[model samples]
Target: MVSQPMPLLNGEPHVGVFIKTASHQVVEVLGAAGLAFGVIDGEHAPIDRSVLDTMLLAGYACRLPLLVRVADGSGPAISSVLDMGAAGIVVPHVDCPEYARQVVAHAKFAGGRRGLSTSPRYAGYGSMSMHEAVCSGDETAVICQIEDPEGVQNAQLIAQVEGVDALFIGPLDLAHSLGADSVREPVVREACEHIARAACGAGKAAAIFLSDPSDKAYYQELGVTLFIIGSDQSMMRQGTRALSSA
Candidate 1:
């Protein structure tokens, strides 16, 4: 709850972007874009642990609240990122209520008993009081990614999970699940709309997977608070493309 994009929850909306660039280079550029926050997508992007540690450090230095999309739900895959101090976790393909419950438990210490270490960067390297760190760890989000047809069918139950603050729709996955390769198809859009309505009704935020800078109004109409605008690779290409086209 603490890590939610407050704009979406409190009746305002923040437009954010996704970072798929090298961890080092993206950190400085990420904050300069005038967006709220960024997701360092370790799940889809190829990034190493050593580089990730550095990237997160630089991200913290720049004061960008980061959400790391965990590649999997396994103990090491998810727990290691939380232990390393990611402010939020975007878990993909969470279809059932038990999966939703487990995501929360893994993110929370009292709820799931994740191992803790004082010297990690997430705790400011032991600068934070034990109580404060514990509170932070417990409250950090475990966002569910409703990416498939099955997940969309059960989006409401997934959103209602005790610690699931939001349900994020992955456009590509949704499209694929709908027997298409492109997200612009009507079937995927319709399903996403269904997920959005379910999230709003359940008192949880909905995150749109589109990263287009021009899609603000579209997401707003659906009550989406968290916006992953564009990937780092896309930004780099667009920047260069714009210059040439100009």
Candidate 2:
């Protein structure tokens, strides 16, 4: 029988928070705050594998699903995080169906080239059989980021690619690609809506990074169910301001 997919990609409304730092404390805090998952920002953060491993362990302890947004969707990049016990991978800048396929190729082991290592943390450190490990890896989530104009244009095709569990809209980079003044520009909003429609049409999840919670209702109306709202640094700044004002 086919096993169930990971929680992150189970066609449910999930909320995630981004972690730019290597602090396990932040993961603990976010878990306490009731976020469904935590994403480690490897794309922009200077986090080394050692730090990432620690954070992953912490998240596991906290019973929170931890996904790594790798620097890129390279095979090695995706394989390393999977071996480290990440619940899934979030690939950046997938502009076409081929790129989305490549991301899955690296994230999934059935048709992909992910190296096998039953001794890794993901396999229970040699406890799990190779067959079980491979099946588990295949079920791991693969979320593709649709950031550029090309990605938005091909969003539907990308969503239809097998093993691509979700489409995440990176508004900042998308705004840059569209030559818009800000992510809130009408043009960017239109592009986001297009991508969301594509995801919904393909029976996949539509996700976004919303800096402001107030924008949630707008995107929700457009069929966006997965929301990654705010980051560790932004939360710190807000906390600092609150403390200083008190």
Candidate 3:
């Protein structure tokens, strides 16, 4: 079966949350809540392959497109997550154009070195043909994270790279990389804007992580369409704090 177009690629404003709970139930809840999407925080969370598998299954059943933030952006890591039926990947620390190209190459079956597999869940348990699998795999969004100073510098070139669906700003890491104390610092905001402009100018989606959901409108004005506002853990903390106060 051919893959459907991802919402993030539609150039429209979409808001999602990061998944740190490693629970399929959470995925189901998020989907039922009508969130546009969810990103499994494989980069910082304790989600293993088994957990990922279950979450993807739940996401599919609930109509939630769940992407993975891979700790290692290697070809094997990227392909493995895609094979398990992830909606796409959020590869971290893509600091250069060459690295961006490598990410795209590893993600695409046409111009990249992604290993083919019809046995994975993504191919519907070997029910799909090789051509169909390849077509579906190639459609998965390949988002490259711009988290460092070098990444901000090469944002334009990275955005210009073919096959890169979006440029996601990891603001916390980016602020740390730039020796800033907070993501709200003017310098950090400036860098974020520059990256957003670069991505928008190249006609790619500009994505960002925001601790405060209220900040989305600010970034939206900068041409950022993809917003990851908060994570499961953070939401739970806020809920409990509110309960305690009450």
Candidate 1, 1-246: lDDT as tens digits: 122222334446766667776666677777766667778888888887777777776666666767889887766777777666666789999888888888887777776757766556666678777776677676666789998888998999998888888889888889887898778788988898999888889999888767666766887798887778777788889999999999
Looking at candidate 2, the ten consecutive residues that score lowest on lDDT are: 1-10
Error of 2 at 120 (Å): 0.6
Candidate order (lDDT) = 3, 2, 1
Candidate 1: regions farther than 4 A off: 1-11
Q: List clashing residue pairs in candidate 2.
A: none
Better of 1 and 2 by lDDT: 2
Error (Å) of candidate 3 at residue 149 is 0.6
Q: Global CA lDDT of candidate 3, please? A: 0.90
Q: Residues 1-246, candidate 3: write the lDDT tens digits.
A: 234236777878999999999899999999999999999999999999898889988888888888899997798899988988888999999999999899898998998999998988888888998898988898899999999999999999999999998999989998999999999899998999999999999999999999998999999999999999899899999999999999
lDDT of each: 0.77, 0.87, 0.90
Better of 1 and 3 by TM-score: 3
Instruction: Kindly provide the TM-score of model 3 when superposed on the true structure, using C-alpha atoms.
Output: 0.97
Give per-residue CA lDDT, model 2, range 1-246, as digits (tens). 122224766666788889999888888888788788888999999899998988888887777888889999898999999888888888999999998988898888788878888888888788888899898667778899999989998999999999998899999889999999899899999999999999999999899999999999989888888899999899899989999999
As a TM-score, model 1 comes out at: 0.91
Q: For candidate 3, what's the RMSD? A: 1.2
Which is better, 2 or 3, measured by TM-score? 3
